[model samples]
Target chain A: MNESERREAMRRGPLHGPDLTLNMRSDPRFLTGARGLIASVAEKIGLSSTSCAQVALAIDEALCNVIRHGYKKRSDAPIWVMVWVLADEGVGAGLRIVIEDEAEQVDPSKIRGRDLADVRPGGLGVHIIREVMDVAEYEMRSPVGMRLTLVKYDRPSPGVEPAAVGA
Target chain B: MADQPGLNVRMEQVGQAVVVTPEGEIAYTEATQFRQWMRKAHDASPERIVVDLTGIEYMNTPGVATLVEALQSAKKNKYRLVLAGMNTNVRSVFEVARLNTVFEIVQTREDALA
Candidate 1:
């Protein structure tokens, strides 16, 4: 295939993300805006500012991973991000989010958040997810994809045992 | 753009005021640094406090909570707290969390000058 022809074919592959979810875009600038959306939903669900912030950071990291590592530098690739505020229909009653991305399978065993001792810029995404959300699950989807579930409870973290509780 | 750390909350106590600046992302990982700075600033017993967020990059959930907690503590200690220099992202966070009504946000460091 010629260069132009290959480019057109890639464009035709998959450009549209799941319309069912909230505003999910590939633009990094819009990430701040997405976090804003999460914070709004979190407030309605009675999330503290800290919890809401964690949720924002967690979602930001997750989406970034999908866009960068998941999409493999493909501009036209699609990533699925869904938000379920006050959703209780799942196996357990709580706010849940299922983020599906069209990328290579992510091995849960190999995933580890950033370590506090290390001051690296990257590698902190997954760690933020695990620390912020009540629970985080990473696994492969049935048909052909990777799925990540993030859950949050309304209860305040009393005497919150903060991780890496030092500068 | 540079993926800078969300905040770099540095504190300096003036004669009767304190100034804080946050620089990087404030997710769960960086909340403790923020907490320490806040704890230290509160210990100074400033008559007025100004938090300058001009250089701040991004702030996650824990950061937001720390700010709220800081604001409340300032109020409790009879310190007039002024938060200024919010970028679009920071402003969006306050607006989303509905803290715009709870804190005093200004346009510049000059506005927060004691």
Candidate 2:
């Protein structure tokens, strides 16, 4: 899909489940609650336990970036989160989490994970988000701020044996 | 140190080492509290420090960053810092960052003490 088409798909989301929306303050205290909600929603949408945890972690990292870099630790700043359960044809089932913040915007193309060779703190958030989510996209919002959309499709491992029927 | 709502930290001295165990989530919300416990444990001036992560099932980049800071401090001060009892979820973050090779990690706290 082209850039505009992908953006439109993201905007429309999937029609499987009701979208969960949260407009929260940019405070660290809110992260735990948000993580719990995302994990629960991901699980309800048929994501595996591991995928649920990974999706939650990705959302947590995205919010942390908004609070730390975008808002510069300003607790009162506004941050919005929207979660959707995707069931696109051929793509199977998945979860999408979009985080928006009303803070200074930066070039999404320049938001690359730092080199891990240096072994430092503070720069691993982006890497974690990208690694956990199948699709990690960053874009500048109108007026001001940034938006990060992360999607993870449910792909069950074939190596694991299926649960015994009734036993 | 006292425990927060979502995170709790306990520290004890064992032989020549200080073991710090943190329970609950250690993401951005609790990283500062977890770091304070690490600081307190380091302040005791033990020959080694081992962080026992058995009770923690979820940890984010901030949590990993806090441990990294502790590791760097241990290196600068000529002391040993080890991590133990990381669940698969927590360990994956380390593996993704390729920090499994940088820090000393053990399967159990007893192994860390050893």
Q: Compute DockQ for each candidate against the true complex.
A: 0.06, 0.87
Count of steric clashes across candidates, in order: 15, 0
lDDT of 2 at A141: 90
Candidate 2 lDDT over B1-114, as tens digits, reads 567788988899999899999999798878888999999988999899999999997899999999999999999999999999999999988998899999999999999988
Question: Pick by TM-score: which candidate is best?
Answer: 2
For model 1, the superposed segments whose C-alpha errors exceed 4 Å read A1-20, A87-94, A156-167, B1-114
Cα displacement (angstroms), candidate 1, residue A90, comes to 16
lDDT of 2 by residue, A11-64 (tens): 556766548889899988899888889999888877888898888888888888
Position A34, candidate 2: lDDT: 88
DockQ, Cα level, model 1: 0.06
Q: Which ten residues in a row have the lowest lDDT in candidate 2 chain B?
A: B1-10
Q: In candidate 2, what fraction of native interface contacts survive?
A: 1.00
